[model samples]
Target: MSRRSRPRGAATAAAERRASSRALPQLELGRPTSRYGRWRAATLVLVYVLMGIHIAHWRIRGRTLAPLELNEVMYTLELGVVTAGFLFMATVCIATLLFGRFFCGWACHILALEDLCAWLLKKIRVRPKPVRSRLLLLVPPLAMFYMFLWPQVLRMLEGRPLPTLHLRSDEQGWASFQTTDFWRNLPGPGIAILTFAICGFAIVYVLGSRSFCTYVCPYGSVFRGLDRLSPGRIIAVGDCTACGACTAVCPSHVVVHEELQRYGTVVNPACLKDLECVAACPTGVVRYGVGRPPLLRGWAAWKPIRRPFDFTWGEEVWLALVTLGVLLAFRGLYDAAPFLMTLGLGVIVAYLGLCVLRTAYQRDVRIGPGWLRRAGRVTRFGVAAYAFAAAFVVFWGHSGYIRYHEFAGHRAAAEAVALAERALRAPGGETGGEPHDPGAVPGLPDPTSPTASSGDPMDEPNIVNRSASRAISHLEQCARWGLLRPPRLSDTLRRLYTLRAEARVALSDLRGAIADLERVLRLDPGAAGVHYNLGVLCATSGRDEDAVRHYSHAAALNPTDPDVFNNLGFVHLRRRAWGDAERSLRRALELQPSHALAHFNLARVLAASGRPADAARHLAAAEQLDPRLAQPADPAATP
Candidate 1:
């Protein structure tokens, strides 16, 4: 019988067999959904809210929050010190070694922000296409080396002492919970917020979610290294239908199914451990468990790594050179702007340069054009490229000029402070024994004073006041331009204020001195020296209450300093708080057995408390330590 004449049931059976034979192996035909993803989203939102609250509190109250960026670790490493941020990063690296790049998928603040950007794009029907370039993988390692390791190596080569591990334990500002001038402790607000936008959102919009991690993040390189040895992984057991669903859902563009099929586990360092593959599998073959060490997998077991984009070897070399050049060119721009912004700017410029070069090349080889026409095309292309290049050069030159002016201002301020400090240190209060000419310092002009040429070096008050005023002017210029945003620059401003206060004191401008000292304290409340100086200034100006408060702060900042304790005692004695004065003076004596001034202060406190014999013993000891205390009796003598 012909096929059409066959019984209906037999025909149906035959059709079913044919359909089964043609069936293709695939993952379940649906979008992968996971409870883990929901959990991650919820956790990330909570973390973001808490961080926002922390930053808000810091901004409003001027308090130090925990250091949150990899740059902080770089800063600590540059100084040969280990800060709390470095320890925090080290802990994350350890966790990566055990659990893979879980943080990248679950907890990283930047990634969370990028995901939000991606979701927004998706809502607008602009699905982000994942971009992968093998050549770009070189960035993270290079960044890590340059940012965190190169400085230490350079210091060593320069014969510097090994970086010290300065664990900040003091409760003033270094301690985790202490209040600080947070705005002064880190980069300026412009750089900080712009960096987040560039790295977290702008990069995502251009290169896809987590592009910063794949191509730029220095800390991600550290995590990638540790993740290779991570035993925890997603494995395919029994059988896995080679469905592309897992790859579709992978934000990192990892070939998840292929990795599992070849090595029986996902060993890609980029694997986020997001669990989407397991959730999407229909055959119940995918699982999460401790596996054989990923490093133990033989080379033969490795799958062919395919990138979404490919480049010729020459292209890769050119790209790498361009990246290195940009990195070198923008080395110190981090203080002025975000490193991400600098890198992004460099990338944009390099890409445009390449495009221009390629256009010139194409124009030179025009097929149908005569030699004259080709020459004209080449000329036009050259002019356009030159103009483009010139624009970038001018931009860079303008930036350099701004930086130079800022540097000059800082140098002038520093020179003024040095001059003032030298006068302050002169023996017998000869503050203006010899005026140092500001013009002598390189890159620093003389203060524009009408009397500068005619001024007498021995005119102590005029010289001190003029130098301090010049310093204040320079620092104020820096502040106005936001050049004093970096921690080092802010500290310079603080020192400048303190120096100006000293100059004010020399000129007997008590109110000006107090104002300058107050500014100093506001900039860096934990500065023990500034606090002590403020206390002395206040006490001399007869503001005993203000003096006591400043003295207490000084004592808290420098608990081991006998001078701080001695001054605190003196302030208490001035207030006639005999009990507090006695306690502070004794603590000062305990800190320094040879504190002769503390002995005298303690004797005064003892005499006031009616302990005449004890007072006499302290007085005898004080006179032995320093005969200046052996004076005619005065019941209200100040220490």
Candidate 2:
């Protein structure tokens, strides 16, 4: 009976070998054509064009389209409002639920940038190997929570009221095409370029093309979760020989062959639905279609192929703790560094720390050579590591120094603006007084004169000029240090110029004020407020033609602003264009019925046009709105 059983087993083994040999030939498959590559490129181009259009519309028409950032939505959610960004994110989430991360595969701008990096790496014949670790996967979810959920949760815990749900349309939309303000929205060019290199290119060069998507992007976590319940999936049909061709071409490192063999579908969330696997399959068995839910297969569906470097549960726990701790430790550095740079720095530090601990542990255990040899090896490694770390520290310190100067400059500029505002509101003392020394303290009354209590309408003591000088000094220092170019700090420079202009106006330096205002206009060409200010300055200097042009521009940019219309009418009245003045004054009154200045200005225009009855009615309305208009003009207040 034993002989019969042995013979039967040998016969069955022989039959299995024969069947396997006959079923599929050992065909060595080459690289498959990237069928979706063109589609991805097209989609990326289209998205970019749309973004450009959005920026153009904002710059040209002074209106906002929807924002394109998922982080914007997260920010709005924290504020408990549904902005255009939120609506856009909702649309993406719904589409992901239906089609399974198609945006990540085809439309993401960052993904396109990363893919371009990958293509360049391929040109240099450098193919990166993927580091597969389940522990690393936790980062995206943690980041998602940190960015989108934690702020609101903390607010709730602090007993803060949930903000009302509303769209945030107050500011010009998220991204700008205006070169000056556009750079302000991003990290400084230096830091931005570094981020693209380290997070996008360097990461992909070392840890594979999809490494950032897999381990860092918070938005990817949302899409990954939605993809699990998606109906669209790649399923196996017909003859599948378990050939590894499909797996070889997967940029995301998905075990396509094993997944197909086990569950007859690609159930891995990392599968980007790139369709390279389907194109690479020799048997033509893999195709995208509706399939049974992978979850129905239970535990068997998730059995993963373990690699040699796969982390044990203990190691995973340790790594996770270390990563979280490092992330918290470096949170304050985010303003100095871009988000991706911060994440990459945290990862590097955590990895290095873990390496040190691991080396020490191995040394203590005598895992390799004798104590002396191990100690020598460790010393060599420590020296190399220390050198790299020291260089990194120096670079970090330099960056911190730059950020410090930027902060100091911004603070000084803010103080200058506050001082200027106070000087503007302060009561003017005696007119035709000697100019105070530039070094004298502002907001102080002159001690030598009996009429010192009466403030100068033109700030004749030079208080605003002194404050603006201090601001200009700080701004110049910032510019010298190259801190003024950062988008975050550009507005400070603009404010500095504006403060300088106001100071010039108070000093009766009309030409200098005009030059400063022109600089401000160049920096923000679409600023309606700046246009209005320029119009006022031009009018004060008797440049009636320039004032008319500037006021017309201000009105066009902000048609709803009654001040703009009123100012435009005032400029027209100075030019003695009765028709234009009357029309603009009526429009201003239409916008705001209680505008006394508009009523008085209209009365003057009506009187100039020989309409005594109309002029009398408007004069009465002006007097009722503001009785001060009925009083005789004070000689001291005249510019």
Candidate 3:
């Protein structure tokens, strides 16, 4: 059976050449057909219909089965929420152990999306050339580590314990099984659309069909590992013809004939077992069969691991750097892009980046249907691509700038807060009372000015002198950028303003702090914490009327907070509004019976109103709760 003597239909020269080049070659024995396509298509359609009904049930009934998303594996690992997705993934893994990787071929929505995109491109006669790189193949497994293992690693580093595993119902909110908020774990509408566009369509068009499964899907990496132990496989059941038609029809781009010839079975983890090859085999040789798993096959199993990569060493390095840059630039861009979408975007950008570089340096380059460079000259198509890439680079640069400022501001603010906390906790610094009491105003040595130092570097006053200046500067820059671009950093403006207020408070600038808090309210009028902080600042500044107003607003926003009611009571007591003062203090005690501050304040209100008996009882309770609230050594001193 010499090559020339074998049947021409068995292995055409063109088919052999295409197979060697790792491209989809036309079959000599007519176009290869898929027996499983219609069934898989119908199954995918039914899956989608069921998904719609699930969403509808949640909408109409207000609670339903939790979303069967694979990513809920994160919740199971990090928070110990045993979600439906966690159970679903466990079921699939068990099934894969017995029957191989059929879920991906027949059930995955993303796979359906890639297939549809490929079919549409075929209609237009556009065959995408798949780009293969060894470095790019590391992405999925690396992503799997980040998704499932990194959080636990961080928790260990931070000396945190694992969360307790528990089930929850809808009434508890954000539950695992029956969730009222169906979209809580899902991405926003904009992100969902972008995910579909990039992962489903763009990656397929740019890097060939099923590119997402190969280069970006973290879940696929898990399944691929599990597939190594699966006994179910596509094995040769009959004759010895190698026409390469099975490879031509494989949507996953697996070289079916090569694997079969080397291992006597489809051992590639990339094989989805869609059975396209079974239908395409002219001799009826390929079929499903039980066999020893790869693990049990010993050293002989390693023979089929000689697939050639598409890039040289230098080009691989370039692809790695470009892809990493694109991933960092696009991930969480404008606080919207999700990690998976960014990974797909990275692959596309890396491909285009290489094409652009080739257009400039290499000869006879073509992308899609257009010649980018030919005969060492740049064509009009090359210029157009260059223009588009240039615009994209500009956009990337701006996004980088915004991210830098946001990150820097947050880092500086964190340092400032740590410094201020250290100073407040220093020996001879503000102490006596509970540091966390929201209703208590600081009685500083100099209420009207920043603390004066005795020219000692180690002095607490000197330590906090410039603690927040740098933080304020960075935050101001970030805020300015956010202001110029509405909705760019709009979601973070409230947080920025709140942090700035804390920084101002550290500097002993109560007015500046109040102004920043007012800005926070403008951003988020319902923020109870901001209102409470503003009330404290106003009380320290002797603006009793404004303090009462802010405390009232805080109380309305968060009725469960006893601190707000206590603070409002104190302000009313200062203004000599006895009835109002007593009511607020009593409400505070109702929320928290052990609130010493509220008891102390209530006593003051009762004493001012001449209810001596009631005042004495509350005073006794306050003194019992906190002995510091008792009368000082000097009889003239009032608590």
Best by lDDT: 3
Better of 1 and 3 by lDDT: 3
In terms of lDDT, the poorest run of 10 residues in model 3 is: 427-436
Candidate 3: tens digits of C-alpha lDDT, residues 468-551: 455556556656654244363444445545544554454566787788779878777898877877888888788988999999
- State the local distance difference test value for candidate 1: 0.65
Off by over 4 Å in 2: 1-32, 52-66, 171-190, 295-336, 348-386, 394-639
Tell me which of candidates 1 and 3 scores higher on TM-score.
3
Q: Write the per-residue lDDT of candidate 2 for residues 1-639, one digit (tens) a residue.
A: 222443443345446656743643332333324666666667877877987887787677665554556666765666565655576789999998887878887787777777778777666665655555577788889888888889889988999887876553345433321222333334666786777676677667655677788877889999888887787888898767887778767777777777888778888887788787788777789888887655555776555443334344555667677656555444334255656566655554554445445453333212112121153255654656567667855655554555555555666777777776666534343211221111111222223335332345455336656655665665565456542365545577677777776566555566877787787787789988777777766766678899889888988998987767777787787778888988998998999998777877787788778876887788789879767667354211211
TM-score of each: 0.56, 0.55, 0.75
Residues 1-639, candidate 1: write the lDDT tens digits.
334554454456446545632442332324334787678888789878987887888778766556555566775665545555667787888888887888888888878887788766666656554544567787888778887789888988999877675655335334432436444346676776777787778777656667777878777888877877888888887777776566666667677777778777887787878787667666878888888656777765333344435334544566666655665455354256655556654544444455444443333321111121143255554565668677976766545554554555576776776676556543221111111110111111112323222345466545656665665675565466542356666677677766666555555666887798788777877877777777766766778888888878888888897767777787788788988988998998998888777777788888888887888888888789777667568534443
Span of ten consecutive residues with least summed lDDT in model 2: 432-441
- lDDT (C-alpha, whole model) for all candidates: 0.65, 0.65, 0.75
| Model 1 regions more than 4 Å off | 1-34, 56-65, 75-82, 163-166, 169-179, 183-185, 298-304, 325-334, 352-393, 400-639
Error of 2 at 142 (Å): 0.4
CA RMSD, predictions in order: 16.5, 14.9, 8.4
